[model samples]
Target chain A: MRRDFLLSFAGHVLVVGIAALVGMSRAVRDTRRPIVFSVSVVSGGGTPLPQAGAQGTTLVESKPKSQAKAQSTAQSKTPAKGGGGSGSGTFKRQGLGVGVEGAEALGYSYYLNAMLTRVSDNWLNPYAGQAKVLTATVVFDIERDGTVKDVKVEKKSGDAAYDASCERALLVTDKLPPLPPEFPGPRLKLHLEFEQKP
Target chain B: MVPTTGASPGFLGPFIHAGPFALVDVIALVLMSVASWAIVLRKFRTLGRASRQTRQFLSTWGLRTRLGDYEQVAQRLRHSPLSSLLLAGVKEFNALRAEFGNSQAGPELLQHMIPNITEAMERAASREVAKIEGSLAFLSITTMVAPFMGLLGTVQGVLVTFMTLRGTQIPTLQTIAPGISDALITAVMGLVVAIPAALFYNYFVGKAHELEGDMERFESELTGIMRREIVSSQVEQRKGQ
Candidate 1:
């Protein structure tokens, strides 16, 4: 009887130890935050941006003011990016300018905001002299070590210089901070829209 | 596709940093697991001991040329249910014999004692069966409770996740994955604890029944042996006359 008790106790201990070990081992290196960038580019023309990397992305083309008006009326029929089942979702740009408003947001903004700060600080406005206001969407896949990969330009600003500068800014930033150990995956796919300030 | 180095979240990390409610689930899971393990171990030892005692007693007595004296056999095989039945039947037979050999006629005395001996043996066998079945309900309860504990963790995980969404935009999958994943760990743990308990409960129940069956069969055989002994003694006495 005593022996069985000891054996049972030992078995329970072993199971718990294994669970803890497995949990600890899978921890990610970078701090993890939910992706919450509310970037809505109101550029004219339906042209899809020049995607830099491999295919298979659903990009929302630059819609004219009328379509933007139409989309807002239809917005209620669709799922909100923030409220949807999927972890990754997109929302139409609300209001004017690059200000953050009209959103219930998590502390994750700290992480994404910090990343944006790093990218924007390194950027020299590509459209400074350009007469036409252009926007380019860039997708960057970041390694756990903070190294960036496949910095593809999803939408081209129609100006090579504008597109090149956005791509260069990401590359120059070099490495991002490592993800939190508890983050889901090893690689973080970052999508950013660079709009030329008119 | 080949997974790059950091693709898989370290499997161990989420559990360590899980929320309080998920942690509650973990506590329940641990308790159930410990309980199930203890029951399995104790049941194994008990059923195993009974089986060994029964085998030892049967092998020693079943092959004998003549039935061994019940007192000596019962003393040696103290734990066996068969031994207890044997003692009960023989004791009853002796009590009846002392009262009835008011006839000195052995046949009448034997007939009178057989029915009472069988009844006494049956009662002793039932008691033995109950002893063999002791604590088995615990195993069944453990099996039933384990899965519910896991589900409790899962519900807690979802609740916590949704609660976080109250003041925030719907978070990305990577952000919420850890909590949900940790919550699921409890469920997995519950199953881990329950499956063995369920299997062992059935196994031990079967063993108890088999032991009971052996005692029941042995009771009838004992009655037959006692009748033969009485008839043989009477025939010898008549020949001498």
Candidate 2:
């Protein structure tokens, strides 16, 4: 009986030690704040500005007054400079834009809009009050469950903070709305740009 | 559970900040879990050996006609409860025959002999059952008490959290999160300890009950065989006279 007790005590200690090791080995998870957005009601509040990194004729597009109105009115917005265009024309041009592939045919424009708002909410510009305009382009893959992966910088905006803020925004927005069920694909690859202007 | 002050809170923050009461609860649960697991292992080996030896004894005893034919098999199956039970009955039968003289036993004396032998086997069966069931009570007690011990820690931790908040102008998520997480750890630990103990306790109890039933059946069969052996020997002696 004493021998059995000793054996069991040793076995229990080993099991607990193994479990604790496994638990400690796992990476700690990151938690984030919820997203929030504000809407403006008045018109003539501003004139259009040149889209950042615009190489050719700078189309001075009017700022769409609201997110819902912007999507409906500007469905034909052309993809500008390597798959980088805003899903909605919001005025607060806060260093965040998304360009989705095959979004219109899949009727998943709302998914893009959600991605923009969520990423923009987390996207913080280090040079928020500076007059220097900067734009950094990043590309990444979005799995079906909305997990971001394989994030890489395609274009650097010449400023380290500006580029890092864009990367951090995407990394921190770890989850977005899941892809539309009608869209049949293993994952969606996305190209995005973060533009900071005075 | 004071708020962690560093730029990056360490992963072991909750455990490190656990109160005195919570630490005690954790220690108690850990000991209970270890003890319960020990009983599970020991009972497993004991019951398994008992079952295997009983099977061997029964198979060998089945081939033998005379009561004396069992002595060799019984010696080899010392761990078998059935063997011990049979030995008890046979020993009583031999003593009775010695007292009455093998050739002179009447039907009236035979009646008393059967009951005495049955009584002896009954005593041996109970002893074997007690040995099999030993230490199982500790498992039962652990299952019932570990959960409540965890709950006590949780309640104490929460109470401490609220008390800390009494002086604050406002309680924000950052202010209360650490304390609440510390409190919840004990509850999780409690369930971890109790679940396996409960499962193993039920299992060992069932095995012990099964062995007891087997012994009871063997006792009745052995009694019937001993009675017939006594009666047949008396008949042969009368014919010889």
The C-alpha lDDT values of all candidates are 0.63, 0.66
lDDT of 2 at B45: 91
List candidate 2 segments past 4 Å from native.
A31-198, B5-13, B63-65, B106-108
Per-residue lDDT for B144 in model 2? 92
Give lDDT tens digits, candidate 1, residues B168-232: 54344544665677667778877877898889889998998889888877888888887776676
Query: Which residue runs of candidate 1 sit more than 4 Å off their true CA positions?
Result: A1-3, A18-140, A149-174, A177-186, A191-198, B1-29, B63-65, B69-77, B98-103, B160-179
Candidate 2, residue B84: how far the Cα is off, in Å: 1.2
Per-residue lDDT of candidate 2, residues B1-241 (tens digit): 2343322233454567888889988888878887887788888898889988887877777745568767777889989999889899999888877777443555448657689999999999989998989889998998898888888899999899988889775464445766877887788888888998899889888888888888998898898888778777777778888
Report lDDT (Cα) of residue B112, candidate 1.
66
Q: What is the lDDT of residue A165 in candidate 1?
A: 81
Model 1, position A198, has a per-residue lDDT of 33
**Top candidate (lDDT):** 2
